[model samples]
Target chain A: MASSEEFNLDEYILHHLTDSQEWHLPFLPTIHLPEWLSLHGVMLLLSSFFLTLLFGILYKKEQRVPKGLTNLLESFIIFVRDDISIKYLGKEDGRKMAPLFCNFFFFILMLNIMGLIPLFSTATSNINITAGLAIITLTFMIFGAIYKNGIKGFFKAFIPSGVPAPVLILLIPIEIAGLFIKAFALTIRLFANMLAGHIVIISLLGLIIIIGKVALPAIFLAVGIYILEVLVAFLQAYIFTLLSAMFIGQMLHPDH
Target chain B: MTAATFATIGAGLVTVGAGIGIGLIAGRAMDGISRQPEATNKIQTAMIIAAALIEGVAFFCAVICFMALGK
Candidate 1:
């Protein structure tokens, strides 16, 4: 970004998007964290620590009446339990799995919201992190199905009845691939969304740098995208949890 | 033409495809909600799920285009 000989716009935008040891912000000096732990790593750990401390302290009060933060957290938990988990999985399994679904929702929601804050970076924007999260969902989807339905039932779920034996040869592979494709879609949907959002925001600002004037409309557009990013942060988290519950639900009750 | 150019074009087409698919879904959903306003909540939920599923495919292809651009 520093105009040495010639400034490269692509490099500027990509640099802001990619994770690094140093945190960069407009009109502020770069702050360098430890080389071993990248900026995104710090953001990831920060969100986890914040969530744990917030919940651990608030719930430890053990109040007969829920207070401010406790009230908020409880509401979110109920939303996850009822709207997401129970709605998809049956009542019994939904209750059993509410905790895991809550963890996914809050962790993702926090990670995303943290990114929107100028002080922190977006950890979920990274492909590896999103892929890791999707893999956890995949593990539960595969194992939960097998556990509830047994091995025979797991495979049986793939083979729909009355789909002639001749069609079975072509259908089996596609059905098997569909399982993995769902997880792959989950990974890309998250990574690309965050990636695209950051890129657009940076590019909007980059226009001013490249063109050598403070583009006022560009600033407004960036702010608009920033707000959309916030909405997306929440939406993506909800969608991920919703889909994960849906996948597991589908597995548990294949007939449904 | 360069590979990136082709990838860019392909991504544009993917977006168009996803746009039409979602448009169709939202159109039908609107009709359903208008006919049975009481079921609006259920209809909206189904609409969002379907739209998100198609958006996922679009993003997946866009990511592949990005890989090509990176190369």
Candidate 2:
């Protein structure tokens, strides 16, 4: 119900960016648990719950053959498995990893899209959320590599073939650094894209107020940015999922 | 500069960095696809995924800006 004129740009944007939390613990000081029944938490739970229910319904009706929504969902699943997982990970290994990759994609895509809504704080926009996702991917990459190549082979994989002994001294450190860097980069990408789109949209909207009542041009610019942001919402989500699949694929087939 | 101004600058830089990274990824992907048209789907998919990984880093930078600026 707040008007643009009355609202402070920084405060307004901050309010939207802030996660709804439960009461702050007086004793714990640092622990600011989201209010147990916050809108954000509730939305997250509900979205997850509904997704699970949909999956259940599809599973139970498996014998009936896919149709309508079920058909669409099945097609998407098959596309990710065949196109992304198998293409990168190879057919045999890709099947095992498909579900995990698919889940990560959809979960992130949904969360990113949710932020575009009028009154939602994107959980994926949070560092904790993005970091957790990066960690999950990292865990999969490390463990999957070790599992496929064995511990010795895993370490050996870092040293590309044909490198001289002296070069290895430098290569080993660079390779190790690259491994961690890739994971750290993954964490930043998703978080930044989501956050950037929102900030831009909010800042553009703030322009109308900043320039005062006479700035009609600013209003038009803000509208344009808002539309652009809508497109970015989907693009960012797609980018996040696509990278996750690629990382997993790389780990699955280091030779490639 | 006020925290707000700093946050704006920080966010702008992150996006610029992401743009450059994605441009590189897409360029390589296109080159790969051209070499093997039959593998275009696979190459395109891989490119998109790589772009996302880069985006994740940019996202983290933005988050830091938000934390610094937000009350």
Candidate 3:
């Protein structure tokens, strides 16, 4: 039997906050597995696989006038392509990136919504996962810059043309840092939004224990927060995808 | 006051500041849209982007508060 002394609110909260399981490398046990390979790894893998399977099914069973999940998925894909990718990245590049952007948006949406399910953790809530996603966007940005302007021209565009030598020197580092900061901000934005919602919901529910018998109100409040979190899940996914497209667009046309 | 107390206050201020920032952003966006009704879509898109950026900074401070509490 468990002892009463083992019951600690802080520990309980901390346990709730942390990932349920983790694993390290076989040879180097001290080094934790990368985010994509940890327990959140399963969630990530499932989300990606589910997205692929959904798309494949939708494609194979193309309707004369789409219905059900096919119709819903088509709208989301078209929205991402039109409002997010094309609006930010323009028609030429946007068309090229439409599939990738849709993948990111749906994958993240799946992960965020999964948090609402009992016993499932949010993969995007982890900084490591968000950072890994941001790194993918960063790679796209760099590739876009190189593709648009050529390697030599890409570096040259950073100086902003016709600046004093001293100002140019100062501007160079800032521009480079700005590129990374955009990705860093993206990582933090998605991670914080997801993590904060879970924390708030948990904390609100925890208040029932803290308040000691005034539990009725607390449960209602927690329910309210849970509903709000469902909305946040969709909103954050959309925001992250939109911002990624915007950042990549900036890199593609730095002169603008 | 303890460091955690100070962190709590700091975190509260961060939330307050972000709330104001987002409010101002939405208020201005509404004003812009009202003035130029045709630009409602543009204003709303810009507003959402701005609010997300501000919320990101607030979350950074909230994380700091968590670190303090954990300590």
Candidate 3 CAPRI assessment class: high
Q: Can you write out model 1's per-residue Cα lDDT over A1-256, one digit (the tens) per residue?
A: 3783588888877777788889876789888788799988888899999998888865645778887888888888999999999999989999999999999999999999988887788899998899999999899889988999999999999998888899999999998999999999999988899989999899988888877565757999999999999899999999999999998898889998
**Which residue pairs clash in candidate 3?**
none
Q: Which candidate wins on lDDT?
A: 1
Candidate 2: misplaced stretches above 4 Å?
Answer: A1-7, A22-40, A58-60, A63-65, A209-230, B1-43, B46-71
Per-residue lDDT of model 3, residues A101-217, tens digit only:
997898889999877886456787789989999999999889878988899877876777778898987999999898898899899889888888888888877766665576758
Against the hidden true structure, what lDDT does model 1 obtain?
A: 0.90
DockQ of each: 0.87, 0.56, 0.81
Compared with the true structure, what per-residue lDDT tens digits does model 1 show for residues B1-71? Answer: 99999999999999899999999999999999999999998999899899999999899889889889989
lDDT per residue as tens, model 2, A1-256 = 3675576777777666656663232355433444556645655675577568768765445557877878877887887788667767887888888888778766776776666666446777676777887888888778888998888877887888887899899998998788777777877776666666777777877776677677667768877877786777667655655566677677657788
Q: Rate residue A111 of model 1 by lDDT.
A: 92
- Give candidate 2's error at residue A118 in angstroms: 2.2
